[model samples]
Target: MSNADLPSHCDVLVVGAGPAGAACALWLARAGVDVVLVDQHDFPRDKVCGDGLIPDAHHALRRLGVYDEVMAAAEASRHVACIGPRGGRIDVPGTVAVLPRRELDDIVCRAAVRAGAKLRTPWRFEAAVVEGDVVVGARLKQGDVVRETRARWVVLATGAVPQALQAADMCKRRTPSGIALRGYVKNDAMVGRIKALEVVWHKSLTPGYGWIFPAPGGRFNIGVGIAHSHPARDGEPAKMKDVNLRKVFEAFCAHYEPARELMRTGTLEGDLKGAPLRCSLAGARYSRPGLLVTGEAAGSTYSFTGEGIGKAYETGLLAAETLLAAPGGVPAGTADDVRTRYEAALAALQPRFDLYERANRVNAHPWLADLLIWRARKSERLLRRMAGVLEETSNPGNLVSVRGIVRVLFPGA
Candidate 1:
C-alpha cells in the first residue's frame, strides 16, 4: 500500500506483519474489520528460523486456506530424523516441511493483503496512541516520515522483539525465554542425505539443541538454540550466558556428523544470524485496554521443540475472533471485556506451554534423549507417543516423566 493511500483510521491496527500479526490481520480483514497491517521490513525478507513446519504449522496453513499454496512452495517431509545424545537415531513419522521464513512469511502476509487488509511495509512501530487509559491506535515511522493511525483496537503481532511491547507497556519480561542462531546452506550433496527435518541433542549443546531442516531447492537451514534461559518457577533474574554463539555453533558442527558434513561440503548462503525467542508465555502480558498481543511477542514459541509458527497463526486468529465478537462501540465495559476475553483465550494455551517447559529437560540434560530414543526403539507404544508429541496430540512432559519412564521400561507388561 502506498503512503499516499494510507488511511488515518482503521478498525484494528496490527503491528509487525510476521506470522502472528499477518495471520491476525488476514482474519480481521476477511471479516471486514478494516484492519491495517504494518511491518518494519518488506515482504520476502530473511527471518532467522529453523524453517521447519511441524504438524501445528500445517494445521494453521490449512485453516488459513493457503495450505496448497504453502505446500506448493515448500520442501515436504514425512518424518523427523531425531538423533539422540548417544548417536541413536529415531525416525519419528509426521507431516513436516521446510520453507525459509523469507518465503513463508511473505506467503502468509500477502494472503492477508489478498484478504483485503492494508499492508504497509517499511513502517517501524514507535508507540501506541493512547487516549486516557485505552490504546486507540499506533504511531509508526518509515525512515523520517511518521504516521499516526487511529483505530478502535490494536494488536501487537511483533515476534520476539520486545521493544514494541515495552513501548506499549505490555512487556512483563524484558528478556527472551531463549535465543536461537541459524544460517542457510546451499549444497547438492546434502539434499537427499538431509531429507528429513533433523534435530540433534548433545552434551556439548546443553540448554539447547541443533536443527538442520532441508528446505526446497537444495538449501538447508542449520542452527543451534539455547532453548530456555529462565524457568517459569525461577524467581531469580534471567542471565545471559558468557558463551559466544559462533563457538557454540562450531561445537554443533564438530559434534554432529550431518551438520559437520553439511558445513564442510555445502556452501554458506549468508552470514550466520541469531534471534531471541519468547517461549512458554513467560515474556509479555496477553492484553491491555484497547490492545491485544499475539505471536512470539506473546511468547508463542514452545520451550521443548522451539516451534511457534502454528501457535502464532492460532493466536492471531483468536485475537481476530475476539474483536469480531465485539463489532462496534466503546461502551463503558467493552475494552475491559475484550481484554478479559482475550486473556482467557490465551490462558487456555498456557498448560500446553507449561508442558513444553517441563519437556525441555532434554535440552539441559542430553542423556535424556538417549534414554527416550533407546526406549522408543524398543517399544512401539513409546514411538507412537513420541509421534503424538509432534502432532500436538500428546503432552511432551509426559514423554519424559516418571510414569513415562515406566511406560518405556515395561511396555504394556
Candidate 2:
C-alpha cells in the first residue's frame, strides 16, 4: 500500500486495485508473473455497491481462493426476499451473502500483495505509455511525484470512473450507463426481522430497483440502481436519466414499506453516497494494442441486477488467463493475438449480459414484478427458475420474455 514497492518494470501493469485489478494481479502473481498493481486511493476504502453476493460471486471467490475467507467475514443468507410492486413477496432460495466493498476489496488487495504482486497505493494512472499504436505501460502519479512504469502489457481495472479510461482514450461512452445511491444502517431490532437480501420494484421508482441486504454486525447495505433506465432511441447511444438520485432514494423510502421501517427504526451510519456504473460490457474496448481492459472499466456490470462483483472478478481472471496462455506468459509483441483472445473471452459472456438487459424491463414496469411474484407464489417451477437467475444457472430472459408473460398469466402453463 506504499509507492516504495513500485517496480521499475513488470510483466503487466494493473491499474486500479479494486476487485478486478486485485484479482488480476493475484492470479498473475500466483502464476509467477511480475505484476504491479496500482490504485489512486489507499487501502480499506469504501466503494458504492449493493454488497449482495450471489452464486457467481461465490464461484469467483472460490476461484480466487478467498471463498472461505470472504464467507467467514460475510453475513450468510438463505434466500432473497423479493417484493413486488403491489407488496407481494417471494423468498427465492440461493447462495446469497453480503459484505461491504471496503472490507471485501481490502481482502482482495492484500491477497494480491501476498501473492507477490507489487502493490502501490495513492499511485493513480495518468495515461497509457503508447509506442505508436501500442500501449506499452502507463504514467502514474502520486501527488506531485510522477513515475513512468513500463510493462509488456497493461490492464485497466479502474472500475466505473471515466477519467482513467478517457485519459487512455479507452472510453467509448463519455457518460455512465447507470447511476446508484447507497448508504449503511445499523439496527439490532431489524437483524432478525430482515433476514434475507431484499429487493423491491416499485412503479414510482421507474427504471430502477431497490435492495436492502443485511450484513453482519446488525448492519444493512441499502441502495437503488437505475440503468438510464432506458432503451436508446433510434441509433443514439444510451443516456443517463436526468433525475436527482437523492429524490429517487427519498422516493424509494416513501414507496417501500421495509425501507420506510428501516429508515424509521435504524440509525443511518453514514451519508448516502452515489456512484455511476458502466454496464452490459459497453463503454470501453476490451483490448487495444498491448493494453487490456477488464472489470467495470470494460463494462462488466449487469444492466439488470447491478450485481457486478462476480463478473468483475471473472473478467480479471480471464485477463490473467489470456496472458498466461501466451508464451512465457508475456507475449510482448503479439498484441493482435492477445487482443483477439482477451476480447473473445469477454464476448463469450455478452449473451448473459443481454439476457440480464431483457430482465431490466421489470425495472421499467414494476407491475410486471407484481404479476411474476404472484404467479411464482403458485408455480414452483417458475420460482425455481427465478432462483436459477440468482444462481447464474438459468437465463433471466426466461422471466421477462413474451412467452414468460404467458407463463405469468397462466401459472400452470
Candidate 3:
C-alpha cells in the first residue's frame, strides 16, 4: 500500500514491527489506544539471530499472550552448557527455547494485530516528523511514494540499523559496540545429542563466544559474537572492521571437537548472515520530547551474552505503559513527563545491564572463565544459582556477592 492510502494521523506511531514495536503496540492497543505499527520488511522475514530464548524472553512472550504458541512451535531445552578455555565445561539447568526469528517475530506481530493494532508491513520508516524540537509523527516510504503520518507520540523500535535514527539526527554515536554472525544447519546427529544450549569460549575469540542452539526439525542455530572494543594481545584497542567474523566462526567450529562433530553430518541451510549488536553499556539516550526509542535502537542488548529479545520486549512494554499513563494520550505539554518516566524506567533496569557489562569484562579473560566453569561443574549449588540467573529468577550480581564468591571459592562451604 502507498503512503497516500494510509491514515494521516494515529494516537501513536510505532516504527519497526519487531519484538519491541509489536509488544508496545499490543499493550497500547489492548489499553484502547489507537496504535499503528510499521515495519520495513514483510512477514516471515528472517533476521540474523542465535534463535535462543532465555527465560526472560519466554516471560515477555507470555506477557504478550503468545507463550503457549511459541513453546508448542519451538524446541525446548532445560540445560545450558558453557565450554570455557581449554575445554573446561559446566552444565547448568534452566528452561530455555529456540524459535527462528522468521517464526517468532511473525507470531508476536500477529498478536499485536489481533490485539487491535494496525500493522503496516513493508512500510519503511524514512524520517521523524518534528515540529520544533517535538517529534509529531513519521514519514514512511512505500515503493516510490513517501507519506506523512502524524501521531502524538512516535516510538523508534528500529533495531540495530541506524539509518532512521541518523535521518532524524537522534543517533548519538555511530559506532556499534558488538558484531555477530549466525547460520542454520541441518544435522540428524544433533537431534538427540544437542539437547542443551551450548556456548564455547576460545582463547582466540576473547571478549566473544560461540553458541550452538537446538532448532526445530533437527536443525541447529550456530553463531559467534565479539565486542568491537575487544582488547588485543598487545593491549591495544581492536578495530571491528579489521576482524573477520565469518573467518573467526569457521576457525571456531574447526578448533572445537564438538562443533566439528556437530557439523560432520550437518549442512548449512544458507549463507552465513551477520548483524551489528548495539549494547546498552554506555547508556544511549532513550527519549526526547515526543519520540521514544526502544529495543536495540536504544541499545538494550546485554553486553555479555548479546541477548536483546527480552530487553527489547521490556522497553516496548515500558513505552506502552508510559503513554497509557499519560493524561489525554500524551499531550504536547506532557511530552517532558513521558521522557522523564521512560528514562527513569530505563534507569531502574540499569542494574542488570551494569552486572552484565562487568561480566563481559571478566569473560574476556579466558583463565577466569576456565576457573569459573571448572568450579561450577563441581558445585551443584553454584550451578543451580547460575541456572537461576539464566532463568531470570535470580540476580546476576548475586554470583559476585561476598557470600556467593565465598561459596564458589569454597565449594564445600
Candidate 4:
C-alpha cells in the first residue's frame, strides 16, 4: 500500500523514542489519543549517559505508571558520593536509581504501548511535509521503504540531532563550549561495594565531572564530562570523543578507593563517545505552529548534571495534558493551544535548573571546590546547602543564607 493508503494515521506523531518521545507518547496514549511513536532504533537501545536517575526522575517515572516496574527490572543505587581534590569528600544520603539507557527506553516505550500507542521501531524521520504555514506530517524512511505519514500534531523529541526539524530554521549553532564523553563497564568483582553513583570533582576535569553509576546485571556505566571554557582550548579538530576519556577515568579510579577495587576485574568497554553539552539554551521556547519540541530538543536538559529524562517526562506529560484540555477540544489541524499550555505548565510547575547550571560553571574554579568541601566538613549547615543545590529542591532558597555564610568564610572562592 502507498503512504496515503495507510489506514492508521495517528492523532499525534512523536519523533525519537528517547525519554522525551516515549514519555510524550505514553502520556498522550493515556489520554485516549491515537499516538504513534517512532524511533530510529529498536527497543533496548543505548544512549550515552551517566545512567543515574535523580529523585526528580523517579517522580516522573511514577507519573508514567512504570516507576516500580523500572526499579524492579533495573539495577538500583541509593546513595551518592562526591569526590573532591585534597582528599575532601562528602556523601549524600538519597535514592538515585541506575538503569542503562537501553533498558530505560524500552520500559518507557512499553508503557506507551500498553497505553494504546503504536510504536514503529527502526523508522527514521526524513523530513516534514508542510502545508502552507503548518507542519502537516513527516516523510519517514524504514529501511528500503520510504513513507509519508500524516498526523494532526508533530512532537519533536529528537535530542541533539537537529536535522529532522531543521525546517523550523530555529536552532542556532552556539559556540562549542562544553564537551562530554561517556561509556559503559561490566564486571562482577566489586558487585557488593559499588554504590548507586559516584561523582569526582577535580581540577584535571574542570567545569565538568566524572561519574560512576552501577546498573543491573553486574554492569557499570562510568565516564567524564568536561566543559572547555575557551574555544582556543578545544582539544582538537577531531571528534569530541577523542579527548582521552580513559585517561581521565584511570586517573580518577587510581585515586578513588572504591573504583580502584572495582576496576580490578571489570572490563571498560567501548570508545568514549562525546557530544556538545549546551550550558545554556539556544532558545527555551517549546512550540511553534504545528510543531512542538520536548526534552533536550527544547533544551530542557539540566546542565549541572546531564539529567534530562525526568524534566523531559514532565514536559511530555504537560504537552499531552494541554492538548487534551484545549478549548473546543484538542486542535486537529495545528499546535497552538498545546504549545501555549505546555509552555505555561513547564514554567509554573517544574523548577528551573538554571541555578545549578550556573553553579556547575562556577565549580570549574579550584578554590570554590576547596572552600565548599572545607565548609561542609566544618558545618552540617554547609553540607545541607550543598545538598540543596544539587537536588534542585523547591525550598533551595532556604539554603542561600548558609551558602552566603560559606561564601563569607572564603571570600576569594
Q: What's the TM-score of each model vs. the native? A: 0.96, 0.97, 0.93, 0.86
**Which parts of model 2 have CA positions greater than 4 angstroms off?**
229-232, 235-239, 331-333, 411-413
Candidate 2 backbone clash number: 0
- Considering summed lDDT, which 10 consecutive residues are worst modelled in model 3? 230-239
Best by TM-score: 2
| All candidates in order of lDDT, best leading | 2, 1, 3, 4
> lDDT of model 2 at residue 332?
52
Alpha carbon lDDT of each predicted model: 0.87, 0.89, 0.82, 0.69
Ranked by TM-score, top first: 2, 1, 3, 4
Tens digit per residue, CA lDDT, model 4, 34-63 = 888888787777787667788888988988
What does candidate 3's lDDT look like per residue over 358-390, in tens digits?
A: 667544765666767878878776677788778
Give the C-alpha lDDT of model 2: 0.89
Clashing residue pairs found in predicted model 2: none
Residue clash pairs of candidate 4? none
Which regions of candidate 3 deviate over 4 angstroms?
1-4, 229-241, 281-283, 330-333, 393-407, 411-413
Name the regions of candidate 1 deviating beyond 4 angstroms: 1-5, 230-234, 327-333
Superposition error at 196 for model 2 (Å): 0.6
* Model 2: lDDT of residue 106: 91
